[model samples]
Structures are given as structure tokens and as C-alpha cells.
Target: MTAASSEAVAGAVSPLGRAGRGPHFRRREKAWGYAFVAPALLLFAVMGVYTIAYGFTLSFARWNGFSPRWIWVGLENYIDLLGGSPVYGPPVRAAALNTLWVMIAVPLLTVAVSFPLAVILNSVTRLRTVLRSVYFIPYVTNGIAIYFAWQYIYEPNGAINGVLGALGLGSLQQPQGFLGNPATALPALIVVMVWTAVPVAMLLYLAGLQAIDPALLEAAKIDGAGWWRTNRSVVWPLLTGTTAIVVLLNLRDALQGFQVFLIATNGGPGDATNVLGLETYRLAFLSELAPTLGLASALGWMLFLVALVIALVNQRMLRRLR
Candidate 1:
């Protein structure tokens, strides 16, 4: 047989070449798939997995973040953060408690405000979309700008104090600003966090409201269920899943996010607003003495474990509710 006939014979006999998918074709297809995904995989491996692994490893070592020598301290950093060292223990414990306070307060307040707001928005027959946009605008807007605006509003003579003065309630005003006072700093930040978080939670609740069966609502009305009763009995239970999601997202953000705290208070007013994430950042980079990357990593890992346990417990509780 000639070369072409021999080639045809080989193609017909080979399993891969039987359907016109030769070895070269299969290899090329795989190569193209890898080519499309290689960048993303490489990025995730390096930025996500590798960094987490390295950070975990660094947690057990003692390093100042600039030294080449990493002294292996085993659990010294963890013990110090958990209250072994006087210098680091008190602040770390306080920061952890503050973080827990935020995590609890923000989510509960966000749910309380957002669910009602969503119900009100959903009830509106006119300008519904506009109202939603108005509420959601804060979530989409520049966070730094919003924080600054809120800072001004919380200022000694800014909008809030001005309003209080106009209403003849001047005694309610903070002369050093709400954020400037240790008594009010964390609560003020919680208010802003809830304000920013409300829109998203409301949006999610709106979706849940729409997903609710209209027949159930009609039945509740037929049974003489008023607005409050209807919402409490018929609507709230139905939105448990949505509530769980909103709670979890806000909880995670409150636990991990510190930008608002950084900009608004910088964990100041005598560490009243200091949280775990901010404490970690401060330890790693903004320490008055040497930057303790190892202790920061240990604290971060502890925070992660705390978040995990809380999330799991939350999930179970919410699931039971559902």
C-alpha cells in the first residue's frame, strides 16, 4: 500500500483516530484547556493557597517581619496572644472581645433594620425601584467617601450636633464628636456598619419576600392577620434562609473588615474600637516597636478559627429554625 493508504489504515485501526480524534487532536485540546485556565489556577495557588500555608507556618515562628532569621518558637506566639504576655495579652483579649461585640451587634441590627425596610419597600406600589436604588446607593458608593461623610456628621459641630441644637437637644451632642469618645466610638461605627450593610440585607430580604408564596400571604390576611402579625407569623419564618445568609455575610465582614475602623477611628479612643483584624494589621505593620508578623499570623489564625466555629454554630441554629 501507498503512504496515504497506510495512513488511512492506521487512522481506522486506532481507537483515538476512529472518530477523527487523533492523538495530536486530543493533546491540542487538552493544551488549549490548560492554556485558558493556567493563569487563574496559578494565581489562586500562589495568592490564595500558598499565602495561607505560609502564614500558618509563620504563626509558629518568631520573626520581626524584616529579619532573615525565623526563630521557631512553636506555640509561644499563640500563647502570648491567648494571655501569656502582659504586653500583648491584654490588648489582644480586648480586641477579640471588641471584635465579638461587633460581629454580634452588626448582624442583629442589620437584620432588624433591613427586614422591616424590605417589607416597607416591597409594599410600595409606586417608585419602588427608585427607593431601592436610593437605599442601595450607599452600598455601591465609595466606602472611604462614605466613612469621611459620616465622620463629618459625627463631628462636634457637624450635621448631627447641628440637628440636635436645632431641636433644642444640645446635651445629646458629643463635643469631641461621637467617634472621638470611647463611650460612643464602637457604637457609632456599628451604626455606620449597619447602615452600609442594610441595603444588601434589604435587597436579599426583598428577594426572599418575592419568593414567598402569595397564597400564604392572602391566607394570613383572610385569617385577620394584621401587618405585624402577618410579618411575624407568615413572613419572618419563610425568610429564615435569607436571614441566615445575610447574617453570615455581615458576620464575616464585621470580623474580617477593618477599613471603616481604620479610617473612622483607627482603633483609637484608647483601644475601645480595636478589633482583631485591626489589631493584626497594627501588630504586623504599625507596631510602635518591631513588627511582630508571627504573633499577627497567630492572631489571624485564631480569628479564623473563631469565625469558623461561630459560622458553624450559626448555620446549625438557622437550619433548626428553618
Candidate 2:
């Protein structure tokens, strides 16, 4: 045989040869890959796509959620919701305002606290792991239990009031308790929200700090920059990506989250702690006399759009930083 003929025979016979790359073999490989992914695709189709489509359709219809029939309402739900209808508009608008406050306050406070705390923890040599666990514990703890614990702490006779009395600030005590008072309820909730969010933000900041080169710190020191100045000028700029993530996540949570308000205060004290998410929840699940499912769905979509706009704005601003 010629040299080319021998090589062609070897290539055809080899286990790692053109046969394995043939059309039939490639089709079998693709079939196996699809088989592996089929279950996940099935799950998403049922749980994600179907539910979202159903909810969108429901938003345009009046349904009691149990009735087989749906009355077509067109844009009535959206109008009642956004056009300041006496029945639904006031509470929703107030809740929207409350949600706006949370969206601004939680992210700003979380970043402010977490970044500094992360900086301090990053410098620690002794008990570093333990300290990290301590901070992270709140993030991983049972949510209901944390809310209950904070509820106790906000009680009229709880630790906070006791400390206030001890400090000769008895007149400042809320007779109705922190969560029961209209004036202090939202701020108190904001504190807990910030507390729960801080650890995660701090963890992100800590990871960002560790990824930074040590030489940058040394260079700052050599240039006679103080510790505070170095952090402000050198370290802070490097962690902008981390800050953006932290801020965006917390903003999303603030806009969409309701469990904290639901479990802690139930939007009590004359709607002082009411937020958009909590209002949506109340309309969808809690309102038995009136079926506001359509309205709730409309509100949900509005919230989604608001979050999307704010997130887009945030991304644009962050890009400017870059």
C-alpha cells in the first residue's frame, strides 16, 4: 500500500478517529445532552413561564381566584391602582412612598456600615474566622426567628426601653412600643432591614478587599497617605464593583420584599410601616371580602417596572464611575 493509503486505514480503525465525529455519533451526543437538560426545561415551563403568563392574563380580568369564570376588566385594575381610586389608590400610594424610603435608606445604610465593618475585619489576624461567622450568622439565621427576636426587642418593656430608662431617657419611651407607634414603626423596621442586609454586603466587600493587591496599600503608605485617606482614595475606588452589587441587591430586596413587614408589624399602626410589597401581599392573599387579585397583579407589574427603571439608572451611573 502507498503511504497515504496506510494512514487512511489507520485513521479509519483508530478509536479516536473520524467515525466518532460522524453525523450519527454527533446526533447521539446531542440527544444525550438534551436528555440531561429536558427535566429542567420541563420544570421551568410549568413553574416559571406558565405562572408568569397566567398572572399577566389575570391582571386584566376580575377573578375571585376560586371562580371558574373571569370577568374581563380591561384596564380598570390599573386605573384604580394608579389613578388614585379612593378604595385602592391611597394605601398603594402610601405604600409606594414607604417602599421608596426603604429603597433609598437600606442600600445607603447597608453600604456605609458594611464597607467599614469589612475593612476592620479584613485587618484582623486573631479570631478572623470566628468574627466572620458572627457577622454572617444573621444572614443565615431563620427569618421568622429573627423577626420574633427583634419583635421582643421592640416591645414596650423590651431591652431598648430598658436601656433608655437606664440612661434617664424615660420620657422618650414609646408607650405603644416601637412597632406599635406610627412615628417610630417604619424607622424601627428600617433598622432591622439594614441589620439583616449588612452582613451580606460586608462579606462581599471583604472578598473584594482581599482580592486587591497588597502593593497598592504599601504605595499609599509610602506617599504619606493616612489610613483613612488611603481607604477613601485607593481602596474605595477599587471596590466600586462590589459596592454596586451590594447596592443593587439591597435596592431590589427593599422594593420587592414583604416578609419583614408581614411578620414583624403586618403593616400596622395605621399603615405607617406599609410598603408596596406588603400591600400587594395583603390585596392578593389577605383580602377576603374583596377579590383584588387583578389589582395586586397590576401593582406587582408596576413594582417590577419601577425596579427595572431604577436598576437601569443605577447601572448607567455605575458605568459613569468606570
Per-residue lDDT of model 2, residues 90-113, tens digit only: 898899899999999999999999
How far out, in Å, is residue 313 in model 1? 2.5
How many residue pairs clash per model? Answer: 0, 0
Write down the TM-score of every candidate.
0.92, 0.92
Candidate 1 lDDT tens digits, 30-111: 9999999999999999999999999999999978877888999999999999999999999998998898899899999999
lDDT of 2: 0.92
* Candidate 1: regions farther than 4 A off: 1-19, 318-322
Residue pairs in clash, model 2: none
Model 2 alpha-carbon drift over 4 Å, by segment: 1-21
The TM-score of candidate 2 is 0.92
